[model samples]
Target chain A: MRELLRVAPGGAVDLGAVDPRSTPGLPGREVTGPQRKEWARGQLTLIGAELGRQQEMLFAEAKARQSAARPVGAAAGGGGSDAAAGGAGGRRVLLVLQAMDSGGKDGTVKRVAGAMNPLGLHVRSFGPPTPEELRHDFLWRIRRALPPPGYVGVFNRSHYEDVLVARVESLVPESIWQARYDEINAFEREQADAGVALVKVFLHISYAEQGRRLLERLDEPRKHWKYDPSDVDARARWDDYQAAYAEALGRCGTDAAPWYVVPADRKWYRDWAVAHLLRETFDTLDLGYPPAGFDVRRERERLLGSERTA
Target chain B: MRELLRVAPGGAVDLGAVDPRSTPGLPGREVTGPQRKEWARGQLTLIGAELGRQQEMLFAEAKARQSAARPVGAAAGGGGSDAAAGGAGGRRVLLVLQAMDSGGKDGTVKRVAGAMNPLGLHVRSFGPPTPEELRHDFLWRIRRALPPPGYVGVFNRSHYEDVLVARVESLVPESIWQARYDEINAFEREQADAGVALVKVFLHISYAEQGRRLLERLDEPRKHWKYDPSDVDARARWDDYQAAYAEALGRCGTDAAPWYVVPADRKWYRDWAVAHLLRETFDTLDLGYPPAGFDVRRERERLLGSERTA
Candidate 1:
């Protein structure tokens, strides 16, 4: 299941060759058409429930651990640092998603990730850099947004934009964007080392599919507000964008945090695949309900024998 | 419904006199026994669903507004200041819960507030301040935890602690805790002026209930982790604690952020009351789905003319 979508470390990736309509095999065989869509939807529902429960277990465990570890006189407000309150330092997941405009990043978060416990999930969509952000290192803001332990942090568009959009759009010098590839791989490796399970997903969609979606946003009354005229200009540079993405996937894919090019042409499939990938990520972790640590008989006696009673 | 539990601004409140077991009338006459518990449970379920949907509307509207208002080239990471991204400045909810040990603050959050979308909800359980925090005024940390627009922020235990625990425990001198009542009122008024719907709840549990719950924690192995030996010491000082709470509630309760003394002996009733109070708070606000704001005809033509399509 993990291997089906993973781009092996340093594996060469050609965006032009990988079909945007391809749906990876689930367990045994390849699923397609209506049957595949139905199967994916069912899997999504089941996985959504599982993700919710898993999050609860992690939260409870973290809360208990935090209670046990809090220093004396520490305030009881739930404003402690994420690492302290969340507990189990390395037990977190960061789903780094990179895709072109109209590639379903927002839709995937809304339809799939939205079903999970929002307390345990942090979905961050990156856009253009602010003046302050440009003044610092690119990864500074990314560091601030990393999911706290026991959480699943989704980066709607991640640091890869430094090498992809920055390269294709000439936002920075060639010397800078070209060097970002190494910096990104190292940064992700450090995250993986820290026990943050990194799942980098490239939502793969065709040129025509993007155009259609952009037009749909324009045509639909409710969605018109979401359509941006600037999106068309980006679409005009589609081939160049593809080449930039191809280089990124090939250069940055690593064993610690492999890139998965999910088919974004089909919304159902794309959502299901992303959800499935997330569930599998959780499956690999040692997550469960924490042990009960108090003396049951003595406490029950105390409750029953309390001098002052409700 | 709003009138049922609200403590009129500056109203005299005697903690010793307010029955912890008093159940306010929901609509009609008071209900009793098993029927009352069942009734509260039903309301809890219904209100939970409404809060969830209302949150979605706010989130969608905020997301749209943010996109429209984002300064070009804003940083792409998720760590931007909340005020900037969650536009409309004052469209947010902050529920502040202050209670004695085992007062069901955690339970109320889990059973009622937990049902809302976590994405739009910010739960901050304020603990003792860190050394750095102690250097600043008490309101410093409280201000840091205020939720941005389009979100519901819950302060498990709040600034009132400065007057409540700090007063009873004598952690601070009379000179300090004495002035906090006015400071607290001013801060809450500022929040209300900023458009934050503030509801302060004092989960009024009987002394006996606290003993029973404390013992339950000690007795139950799973809950043993939550039992603090110091809790018994606080229980011993119940009378002093109550006086502090009564004064805090009476003095700080204002038109902008009235305090509600909820009879919390019955877990079912407590959960329902908090959920109901939150729903009413939101009810007073003009929250709804934002209107669609894009060109329909132009977009429709673009979609029809796209050569490559989904």
Candidate 2:
């Protein structure tokens, strides 16, 4: 499944070659049309329920570890650099999503990641940088938004914009934006060392599809709020954006921080693929309920005994 | 519904008088037994979906308003006190849940709030305050975790802990904990003035039910992770905690932040009631999608025209 979507480290990606409408095969064979959509929905429902348990397991592990790290009578809440992270530390996962307008970044999150316990999930969307953000390094705000340990963080749009949109719109000078590819690489490397697993996804949608989506938003009174005129301006430079995306995806795709170009013309397939990829990531991590720090046998006696006392 | 559950301002609360197993009336009359559970489940599912839409509407409006508030060429991201809040502002909501151990707070979040978009929902669980957190006012950390506008925030445990556990366990001096009821009311009033709505809920359960839950946890290996020894200690003093809760609920039940005593003996009823309450909250807000900031007709032309150019 990953082989179809994942770009290898140092791999050259040609955005034009990949079919935006292509749906990857599920386990045994490719399920198509209505059946495929139904299969994906069923799988998503199951996956969502499992993800909820997985998150709680990780959270329990974090709490146990945090308690262990704290000195007795020193008071709860793990201290040190981790103090800022609300006494949580352990394995973390981040999902970075980049897409052209109406490429279903929001849809992917709502469908694929929505069912997970929000306590263990953090979703940060990056649009145009604020003036304060501009004053700092490109990765500054991204750093601030990174998920604390034992969390699954999703970025609707991310630092890739420093290279993609920055290059396409010439928001920053050529030299500065060009240097950012390596800066992002180094930044991601640090996160990886810090026990953060990265899943960078590009929801690949066609130009015509984006235009159709934009038009639909404009026509539907309920969706009018989502229709931005600037989206059209970006649509007009579709070729430039595509070129910029190809370069960014090609340059930033790494073993530690891989990029998956999910064909998003079909929203169902896009959602399924992302969920599948995320489940695969969790499968690799040794995630399960952490053992109780206290003696369970002793606790059981105390718990049952307290009933008599009450 | 509010009349049945709400603890009116300055009202006397007798925790012993209310039946933990009671289910409130629906619109007209109450549904009972299995049928009631099924009905609540169906209602919860429908309410969850609608809440998702309402949250998106509020988010859309917040974005629109934030952009409008910024000066031209301001380079997006609303600046000011709002800058730290991800540029989101509008109607905010806080749902604070309190209960004895095994009161099904986590279960309610899973069954009710699970369907909402994680991007717009923030859930914070307050355990024992950290050394640093204890150094400041009890409300400091609570204030930090308050949901920004356009977001629904859930607190698994909250400031009520100051009066409940602090008084029950004598963790703080009597004078300090006694004064917190007014302090909490003032804090919630400030939040109300800042366009925040508060729904403080106590998941009331019978002592026998809690014992049954604890024994189940003890018996099941998978559930052992959650069986803490301290929970038994807390359970031993159940009556004291109840008294503390009764006092806090009576005093802090302001016009702005009403406290609801949710009968949580039936897990299904507890989830259904909370979801219903949240839906009623959203219903009161003008939560349809915000109107487009730009000319929709002109954008529609530009969107259609882009297809030709592409």
Q: Which stretches of candidate 1 lie over 4 Å from their true place?
A: A15-45, A60-90, A110-123, A205-216, A219-221, A265-271, A288-310, B15-49, B60-90, B111-114, B208-227, B265-269, B291-294, B302-306
Residue-level lDDT of model 2, residues A200-222, one tens digit each, is: 99999998788788888888988
Cα lDDT tens digits, model 2, B221-246, are 77766666667778888888888888
Top lDDT model = 2
In model 1 chain A, where is the ten-residue run with the lowest total lDDT?
A: A77-86
Docking class of 1: acceptable
How many residue pairs clash in each candidate at the backbone level? 27, 0
Which ranges of candidate 2 are over 4 A from the true structure? A27-30, A72-88, A308-310, B26-30, B71-89
lDDT (C-alpha) at residue B249 in model 1: 84
Best by DockQ: 2
